[model samples]
Target: MTDTSIPRADESLDDEATTPVAVDEEIEEETDVDAEEANGAGREKKSPADSELFRQSEIAADYVEGLLDILDYDGDIDELVSAGRPVVEVVGGRLQSLVGQRGATLEALQELTRLAVFRQTGTPSRLLLDVGGYRATRRKELAAVARNAVEKVKEYGEAVRLDPMSAFERKCVHDVVNAIAGVESESEGVEPNRRIVVRPVD
Candidate 1:
Protein backbone atom coordinates (compact mmCIF):
# COMPACT_ATOMS: atom_id res chain seq x y z
CA MET A 1 0.00 0.00 0.00
CA THR A 2 1.19 3.53 -0.77
CA ASP A 3 1.89 5.83 2.13
CA THR A 4 -0.94 8.32 1.98
CA SER A 5 1.22 10.88 3.77
CA ILE A 6 3.91 10.83 1.12
CA PRO A 7 3.47 13.02 -1.91
CA ARG A 8 4.11 10.99 -5.06
CA ALA A 9 5.52 12.59 -8.24
CA ASP A 10 7.48 11.32 -11.21
CA GLU A 11 11.25 11.21 -10.80
CA SER A 12 13.82 12.44 -13.33
CA LEU A 13 17.25 11.31 -14.45
CA ASP A 14 20.28 13.44 -15.57
CA ASP A 15 19.04 15.72 -12.84
CA GLU A 16 18.96 15.64 -9.07
CA ALA A 17 17.52 12.23 -8.36
CA THR A 18 14.24 12.08 -6.51
CA THR A 19 11.99 9.40 -5.11
CA PRO A 20 8.93 8.66 -7.24
CA VAL A 21 6.54 6.01 -5.92
CA ALA A 22 3.28 4.62 -7.15
CA VAL A 23 0.77 2.39 -5.26
CA ASP A 24 -0.40 0.99 -1.79
CA GLU A 25 1.40 1.11 2.12
CA GLU A 26 1.06 -2.51 1.21
CA ILE A 27 2.19 -5.39 3.23
CA GLU A 28 6.61 -7.06 -0.25
CA GLU A 29 8.73 -7.68 -3.04
CA GLU A 30 8.60 -5.90 -6.37
CA THR A 31 5.89 -6.88 -8.82
CA ASP A 32 8.34 -5.71 -11.53
CA VAL A 33 5.95 -2.82 -12.06
CA ASP A 34 7.54 0.55 -12.62
CA ALA A 35 6.68 3.24 -10.12
CA GLU A 36 4.38 4.84 -12.67
CA GLU A 37 2.68 1.61 -13.68
CA ALA A 38 2.66 0.19 -10.20
CA ASN A 39 0.83 3.14 -8.75
CA GLY A 40 -1.52 3.43 -11.74
CA ALA A 41 -0.34 6.96 -12.23
CA GLY A 42 -0.21 9.04 -15.39
CA ARG A 43 -2.68 7.94 -18.06
CA GLU A 44 -3.92 4.85 -16.34
CA LYS A 45 -5.59 5.96 -13.12
CA LYS A 46 -8.90 7.75 -13.32
CA SER A 47 -10.72 8.75 -10.18
CA PRO A 48 -13.82 6.62 -9.90
CA ALA A 49 -17.03 7.64 -8.21
CA ASP A 50 -17.06 7.37 -4.40
CA SER A 51 -19.77 4.77 -4.62
CA GLU A 52 -17.62 2.73 -6.96
CA LEU A 53 -14.71 3.00 -4.51
CA PHE A 54 -16.82 1.63 -1.68
CA ARG A 55 -18.12 -1.11 -3.89
CA GLN A 56 -14.58 -2.09 -4.73
CA SER A 57 -13.80 -2.32 -1.03
CA GLU A 58 -16.80 -4.56 -0.45
CA ILE A 59 -15.81 -6.80 -3.31
CA ALA A 60 -12.27 -7.03 -2.00
CA ALA A 61 -13.52 -7.81 1.49
CA ASP A 62 -15.68 -10.62 0.17
CA TYR A 63 -12.79 -12.00 -1.84
CA VAL A 64 -10.43 -11.94 1.11
CA GLU A 65 -12.95 -13.46 3.46
CA GLY A 66 -13.49 -16.29 1.03
CA LEU A 67 -9.76 -16.94 0.87
CA LEU A 68 -9.59 -17.02 4.63
CA ASP A 69 -12.34 -19.56 4.71
CA ILE A 70 -10.52 -21.76 2.23
CA LEU A 71 -7.35 -21.57 4.26
CA ASP A 72 -9.31 -22.24 7.45
CA TYR A 73 -8.08 -18.99 8.83
CA ASP A 74 -10.22 -17.06 11.23
CA GLY A 75 -10.14 -13.28 10.99
CA ASP A 76 -12.41 -10.30 11.16
CA ILE A 77 -12.50 -8.34 7.94
CA ASP A 78 -13.14 -4.62 7.96
CA GLU A 79 -13.69 -2.71 4.75
CA LEU A 80 -13.42 1.03 4.62
CA VAL A 81 -11.98 4.03 2.80
CA SER A 82 -8.92 5.88 3.91
CA ALA A 83 -7.15 8.69 2.14
CA GLY A 84 -9.62 8.15 -0.71
CA ARG A 85 -8.53 4.54 -1.26
CA PRO A 86 -10.35 1.32 -0.56
CA VAL A 87 -8.85 -0.68 2.31
CA VAL A 88 -9.52 -4.13 3.66
CA GLU A 89 -7.96 -5.09 6.96
CA VAL A 90 -8.08 -8.59 8.37
CA VAL A 91 -7.43 -8.79 12.06
CA GLY A 92 -6.93 -11.98 13.99
CA GLY A 93 -4.38 -14.38 15.36
CA ARG A 94 -2.43 -17.06 13.47
CA LEU A 95 -2.40 -14.71 10.51
CA GLN A 96 1.35 -14.65 10.03
CA SER A 97 1.02 -17.10 7.18
CA LEU A 98 -0.97 -14.50 5.29
CA VAL A 99 1.73 -11.92 5.93
CA GLY A 100 4.47 -14.27 4.71
CA GLN A 101 8.13 -13.43 4.86
CA ARG A 102 8.51 -9.67 4.73
CA GLY A 103 4.90 -9.33 3.63
CA ALA A 104 5.40 -11.08 0.29
CA THR A 105 2.30 -13.20 0.64
CA LEU A 106 0.19 -10.29 1.75
CA GLU A 107 1.16 -8.38 -1.37
CA ALA A 108 0.19 -11.26 -3.57
CA LEU A 109 -3.15 -11.63 -1.85
CA GLN A 110 -3.76 -7.91 -2.29
CA GLU A 111 -3.26 -8.19 -6.04
CA LEU A 112 -5.65 -11.10 -6.21
CA THR A 113 -8.26 -9.19 -4.22
CA ARG A 114 -7.89 -6.23 -6.57
CA LEU A 115 -8.35 -8.54 -9.52
CA ALA A 116 -11.56 -9.80 -7.95
CA VAL A 117 -12.78 -6.24 -7.66
CA PHE A 118 -11.83 -5.49 -11.26
CA ARG A 119 -13.59 -8.58 -12.50
CA GLN A 120 -16.87 -7.34 -11.12
CA THR A 121 -16.46 -3.58 -11.54
CA GLY A 122 -14.63 -3.62 -14.91
CA THR A 123 -12.26 -1.07 -13.43
CA PRO A 124 -8.86 -1.46 -11.85
CA SER A 125 -8.74 -0.82 -8.13
CA ARG A 126 -6.29 0.55 -5.61
CA LEU A 127 -7.61 -1.56 -2.81
CA LEU A 128 -5.14 -2.06 0.06
CA LEU A 129 -5.18 -5.26 2.07
CA ASP A 130 -3.67 -5.31 5.53
CA VAL A 131 -3.51 -8.39 7.68
CA GLY A 132 -2.84 -8.33 11.41
CA GLY A 133 -1.56 -4.77 11.47
CA TYR A 134 1.28 -5.63 9.18
CA ARG A 135 1.08 -2.38 7.28
CA ALA A 136 1.42 -0.21 10.36
CA THR A 137 4.22 -2.32 11.80
CA ARG A 138 6.10 -2.41 8.52
CA ARG A 139 5.74 1.34 8.11
CA LYS A 140 7.38 1.85 11.49
CA GLU A 141 10.23 -0.45 10.56
CA LEU A 142 10.73 1.36 7.27
CA ALA A 143 10.69 4.71 9.04
CA ALA A 144 13.44 3.54 11.34
CA VAL A 145 15.51 2.39 8.41
CA ALA A 146 15.08 5.77 6.76
CA ARG A 147 16.16 7.57 9.91
CA ASN A 148 19.23 5.38 10.16
CA ALA A 149 20.15 6.09 6.55
CA VAL A 150 19.79 9.78 7.19
CA GLU A 151 22.07 9.55 10.21
CA LYS A 152 24.72 7.78 8.20
CA VAL A 153 24.54 10.39 5.46
CA LYS A 154 24.98 13.12 8.02
CA GLU A 155 27.91 11.44 9.72
CA TYR A 156 29.88 10.47 6.63
CA GLY A 157 28.86 13.24 4.25
CA GLU A 158 28.67 10.62 1.52
CA ALA A 159 25.70 9.13 -0.19
CA VAL A 160 24.43 6.08 1.70
CA ARG A 161 22.62 3.59 -0.45
CA LEU A 162 20.13 1.15 1.04
CA ASP A 163 19.23 -2.31 -0.13
CA PRO A 164 16.49 -2.86 -2.67
CA MET A 165 12.92 -2.53 -1.45
CA SER A 166 9.41 -2.74 -2.84
CA ALA A 167 7.86 0.42 -4.26
CA PHE A 168 5.78 0.91 -1.14
CA GLU A 169 8.75 0.51 1.19
CA ARG A 170 10.80 2.93 -0.86
CA LYS A 171 8.01 5.47 -0.56
CA CYS A 172 7.92 5.01 3.19
CA VAL A 173 11.65 5.65 3.38
CA HIS A 174 11.19 8.69 1.16
CA ASP A 175 8.52 10.07 3.47
CA VAL A 176 10.83 9.86 6.46
CA VAL A 177 13.80 11.34 4.64
CA ASN A 178 11.79 14.21 3.23
CA ALA A 179 10.60 15.13 6.69
CA ILE A 180 14.06 15.32 8.19
CA ALA A 181 16.36 18.33 7.73
CA GLY A 182 19.78 18.38 6.05
CA VAL A 183 19.35 15.13 4.14
CA GLU A 184 17.50 13.94 1.06
CA SER A 185 16.60 10.67 -0.61
CA GLU A 186 16.26 9.38 -4.19
CA SER A 187 15.49 6.00 -5.66
CA GLU A 188 17.67 4.33 -8.28
CA GLY A 189 18.04 1.07 -10.20
CA VAL A 190 15.06 -1.02 -11.38
CA GLU A 191 12.29 -3.06 -9.81
CA PRO A 192 13.37 -5.93 -7.52
CA ASN A 193 16.73 -4.15 -7.39
CA ARG A 194 15.59 -0.57 -6.99
CA ARG A 195 17.00 1.08 -3.85
CA ILE A 196 17.03 4.40 -2.07
CA VAL A 197 20.15 6.56 -1.68
CA VAL A 198 20.27 9.05 1.15
CA ARG A 199 22.51 12.07 0.72
CA PRO A 200 23.52 15.07 2.76
CA VAL A 201 22.38 18.40 1.43
CA ASP A 202 25.24 20.73 0.64
Candidate 2:
Protein backbone atom coordinates (compact mmCIF):
# COMPACT_ATOMS: atom_id res chain seq x y z
CA MET A 1 0.00 0.00 0.00
CA THR A 2 1.14 3.53 -0.62
CA ASP A 3 2.23 5.46 2.44
CA THR A 4 -0.72 7.55 3.50
CA SER A 5 1.56 10.21 4.93
CA ILE A 6 3.14 11.01 1.57
CA PRO A 7 2.31 14.37 -0.01
CA ARG A 8 -0.49 13.42 -2.36
CA ALA A 9 -1.40 15.31 -5.51
CA ASP A 10 -4.18 17.05 -3.61
CA GLU A 11 -1.61 18.69 -1.40
CA SER A 12 1.22 19.31 -3.87
CA LEU A 13 -0.88 20.43 -6.83
CA ASP A 14 -0.79 24.13 -5.96
CA ASP A 15 2.34 24.54 -8.04
CA GLU A 16 1.17 22.23 -10.84
CA ALA A 17 0.25 23.97 -14.07
CA THR A 18 -3.19 22.58 -14.87
CA THR A 19 -4.68 25.34 -16.91
CA PRO A 20 -3.95 25.71 -20.61
CA VAL A 21 -3.63 29.45 -20.37
CA ALA A 22 -0.80 30.55 -18.11
CA VAL A 23 -2.98 33.35 -16.79
CA ASP A 24 -6.62 32.78 -17.51
CA GLU A 25 -8.32 36.09 -18.19
CA GLU A 26 -11.67 34.54 -17.37
CA ILE A 27 -10.49 33.55 -13.93
CA GLU A 28 -9.10 37.01 -13.37
CA GLU A 29 -12.42 38.50 -14.47
CA GLU A 30 -14.30 36.25 -12.12
CA THR A 31 -12.22 37.57 -9.24
CA ASP A 32 -13.30 41.10 -10.08
CA VAL A 33 -17.02 40.43 -10.04
CA ASP A 34 -19.10 42.49 -7.63
CA ALA A 35 -18.68 41.12 -4.15
CA GLU A 36 -22.41 40.71 -3.59
CA GLU A 37 -22.85 38.97 -6.92
CA ALA A 38 -19.76 36.87 -6.55
CA ASN A 39 -20.92 35.76 -3.14
CA GLY A 40 -24.46 34.84 -4.12
CA ALA A 41 -25.40 35.33 -7.76
CA GLY A 42 -22.40 35.16 -10.01
CA ARG A 43 -21.39 31.94 -11.67
CA GLU A 44 -18.91 29.97 -9.65
CA LYS A 45 -15.92 29.43 -11.88
CA LYS A 46 -14.68 25.86 -11.87
CA SER A 47 -11.00 25.07 -11.62
CA PRO A 48 -9.31 24.04 -14.84
CA ALA A 49 -9.14 20.42 -13.76
CA ASP A 50 -12.79 20.34 -12.84
CA SER A 51 -13.79 21.95 -16.12
CA GLU A 52 -11.63 19.68 -18.21
CA LEU A 53 -12.73 16.57 -16.38
CA PHE A 54 -16.37 17.42 -16.82
CA ARG A 55 -15.91 18.21 -20.49
CA GLN A 56 -14.12 14.93 -21.07
CA SER A 57 -16.84 12.85 -19.47
CA GLU A 58 -19.56 14.68 -21.35
CA ILE A 59 -17.85 14.22 -24.70
CA ALA A 60 -17.12 10.57 -24.14
CA ALA A 61 -20.63 9.93 -22.99
CA ASP A 62 -22.04 11.67 -26.04
CA TYR A 63 -19.81 9.73 -28.39
CA VAL A 64 -20.61 6.44 -26.76
CA GLU A 65 -24.28 7.21 -26.66
CA GLY A 66 -24.30 7.97 -30.36
CA LEU A 67 -22.39 4.84 -31.19
CA LEU A 68 -24.81 2.77 -29.19
CA ASP A 69 -27.68 4.30 -31.11
CA ILE A 70 -26.08 3.58 -34.44
CA LEU A 71 -25.24 0.03 -33.53
CA ASP A 72 -28.68 -0.60 -32.07
CA TYR A 73 -27.07 -1.63 -28.86
CA ASP A 74 -28.55 -0.93 -25.48
CA GLY A 75 -26.57 0.40 -22.59
CA ASP A 76 -26.91 2.70 -19.62
CA ILE A 77 -24.36 5.40 -18.94
CA ASP A 78 -23.55 6.18 -15.35
CA GLU A 79 -21.14 9.05 -14.80
CA LEU A 80 -19.41 9.37 -11.48
CA VAL A 81 -16.07 9.51 -9.69
CA SER A 82 -13.56 6.70 -9.47
CA ALA A 83 -9.88 6.80 -8.53
CA GLY A 84 -10.29 10.55 -8.01
CA ARG A 85 -11.10 10.97 -11.69
CA PRO A 86 -14.26 11.42 -13.68
CA VAL A 87 -15.50 8.15 -15.21
CA VAL A 88 -18.26 7.31 -17.64
CA GLU A 89 -19.10 3.64 -17.70
CA VAL A 90 -21.42 1.79 -20.02
CA VAL A 91 -23.06 -1.38 -18.86
CA GLY A 92 -24.94 -3.58 -21.29
CA GLY A 93 -24.89 -6.62 -23.51
CA ARG A 94 -24.06 -6.75 -27.23
CA LEU A 95 -21.70 -3.79 -26.81
CA GLN A 96 -18.43 -5.58 -27.13
CA SER A 97 -17.67 -3.81 -30.40
CA LEU A 98 -17.29 -0.57 -28.49
CA VAL A 99 -14.52 -2.09 -26.53
CA GLY A 100 -13.00 -3.83 -29.59
CA GLN A 101 -10.31 -6.51 -29.53
CA ARG A 102 -7.73 -6.15 -26.79
CA GLY A 103 -9.28 -2.75 -26.03
CA ALA A 104 -7.76 -1.10 -29.08
CA THR A 105 -11.06 0.53 -29.95
CA LEU A 106 -11.51 1.63 -26.38
CA GLU A 107 -8.07 3.24 -26.37
CA ALA A 108 -8.77 4.99 -29.64
CA LEU A 109 -12.07 6.26 -28.31
CA GLN A 110 -10.33 7.54 -25.19
CA GLU A 111 -7.84 9.51 -27.25
CA LEU A 112 -10.62 11.04 -29.29
CA THR A 113 -12.52 11.91 -26.15
CA ARG A 114 -9.41 13.57 -24.72
CA LEU A 115 -8.98 15.50 -27.95
CA ALA A 116 -12.58 16.62 -27.73
CA VAL A 117 -12.02 17.84 -24.19
CA PHE A 118 -8.86 19.67 -25.25
CA ARG A 119 -10.67 21.38 -28.06
CA GLN A 120 -13.35 22.74 -25.79
CA THR A 121 -11.39 23.47 -22.61
CA GLY A 122 -7.95 24.14 -24.11
CA THR A 123 -6.53 21.95 -21.34
CA PRO A 124 -5.35 18.37 -21.49
CA SER A 125 -7.42 16.24 -19.13
CA ARG A 126 -6.15 13.29 -17.19
CA LEU A 127 -9.45 11.64 -17.72
CA LEU A 128 -10.09 7.96 -17.06
CA LEU A 129 -12.54 6.62 -19.58
CA ASP A 130 -13.91 3.10 -19.37
CA VAL A 131 -16.39 1.25 -21.50
CA GLY A 132 -17.71 -2.31 -21.52
CA GLY A 133 -15.44 -3.25 -18.65
CA TYR A 134 -12.32 -2.98 -20.76
CA ARG A 135 -10.38 -1.01 -18.17
CA ALA A 136 -11.20 -3.45 -15.40
CA THR A 137 -9.97 -6.33 -17.51
CA ARG A 138 -6.84 -4.47 -18.54
CA ARG A 139 -6.12 -3.63 -14.91
CA LYS A 140 -6.07 -7.30 -14.00
CA GLU A 141 -3.82 -8.12 -16.95
CA LEU A 142 -1.42 -5.36 -16.04
CA ALA A 143 -1.30 -6.49 -12.42
CA ALA A 144 -0.32 -9.96 -13.57
CA VAL A 145 2.35 -8.55 -15.86
CA ALA A 146 3.73 -6.47 -13.00
CA ARG A 147 3.91 -9.50 -10.74
CA ASN A 148 5.79 -11.48 -13.42
CA ALA A 149 8.22 -8.61 -13.89
CA VAL A 150 8.80 -8.33 -10.15
CA GLU A 151 9.58 -12.05 -9.94
CA LYS A 152 12.05 -11.71 -12.80
CA VAL A 153 13.74 -8.78 -11.10
CA LYS A 154 13.99 -10.71 -7.83
CA GLU A 155 15.45 -13.79 -9.44
CA TYR A 156 18.06 -12.06 -11.63
CA GLY A 157 18.78 -8.96 -9.53
CA GLU A 158 19.03 -7.16 -12.84
CA ALA A 159 16.55 -4.80 -14.42
CA VAL A 160 13.94 -6.51 -16.61
CA ARG A 161 12.98 -4.54 -19.64
CA LEU A 162 9.37 -5.04 -20.67
CA ASP A 163 7.89 -4.99 -24.13
CA PRO A 164 6.85 -1.67 -25.58
CA MET A 165 3.49 -0.45 -24.30
CA SER A 166 1.27 2.54 -24.69
CA ALA A 167 1.44 5.29 -22.12
CA PHE A 168 -1.66 3.96 -20.42
CA GLU A 169 -0.15 0.48 -20.12
CA ARG A 170 3.15 1.88 -18.83
CA LYS A 171 1.29 3.90 -16.25
CA CYS A 172 -0.57 0.82 -15.10
CA VAL A 173 2.65 -1.14 -14.73
CA HIS A 174 4.34 1.72 -12.90
CA ASP A 175 1.46 2.01 -10.47
CA VAL A 176 1.48 -1.70 -9.78
CA VAL A 177 5.26 -1.85 -9.29
CA ASN A 178 5.22 1.12 -6.97
CA ALA A 179 2.76 -0.69 -4.75
CA ILE A 180 4.94 -3.79 -4.46
CA ALA A 181 7.40 -4.24 -1.61
CA GLY A 182 10.79 -4.88 -3.26
CA VAL A 183 10.50 -3.55 -6.76
CA GLU A 184 10.20 -0.26 -8.60
CA SER A 185 9.39 0.52 -12.22
CA GLU A 186 10.12 3.30 -14.66
CA SER A 187 9.48 4.06 -18.29
CA GLU A 188 12.43 4.58 -20.63
CA GLY A 189 12.95 5.52 -24.28
CA VAL A 190 10.48 7.48 -26.41
CA GLU A 191 6.86 7.03 -27.38
CA PRO A 192 6.02 4.15 -29.77
CA ASN A 193 9.37 2.78 -28.63
CA ARG A 194 9.23 3.28 -24.89
CA ARG A 195 9.25 0.34 -22.46
CA ILE A 196 9.06 -0.27 -18.74
CA VAL A 197 12.12 -1.09 -16.67
CA VAL A 198 11.51 -3.13 -13.56
CA ARG A 199 14.27 -3.31 -10.97
CA PRO A 200 14.89 -4.19 -7.36
CA VAL A 201 14.18 -1.42 -4.95
CA ASP A 202 17.21 0.59 -3.89
lDDT of 2: 0.63
lDDT of every predicted structure (CA atoms): 0.72, 0.63
Residue 160's C-alpha lDDT in candidate 1?
A: 95
Over the stretch 39-106, how does candidate 1's per-residue lDDT look in tens digits?
Answer: 44322344566557777888888888778877899999998655556778899999999999888888
Root-mean-square deviation per candidate: 11.5, 14.5
lDDT of 2 by residue, 70-158 (tens): 67889998654333345678898887787776676776666555444554545665555677777667867987998999999999899
In model 2, where is the ten-residue run with the lowest total lDDT? 24-33
After the best TM-score superposition of candidate 1, give how far the Cα of residue 71 lies from its true spot, in angstroms.
Answer: 1.0
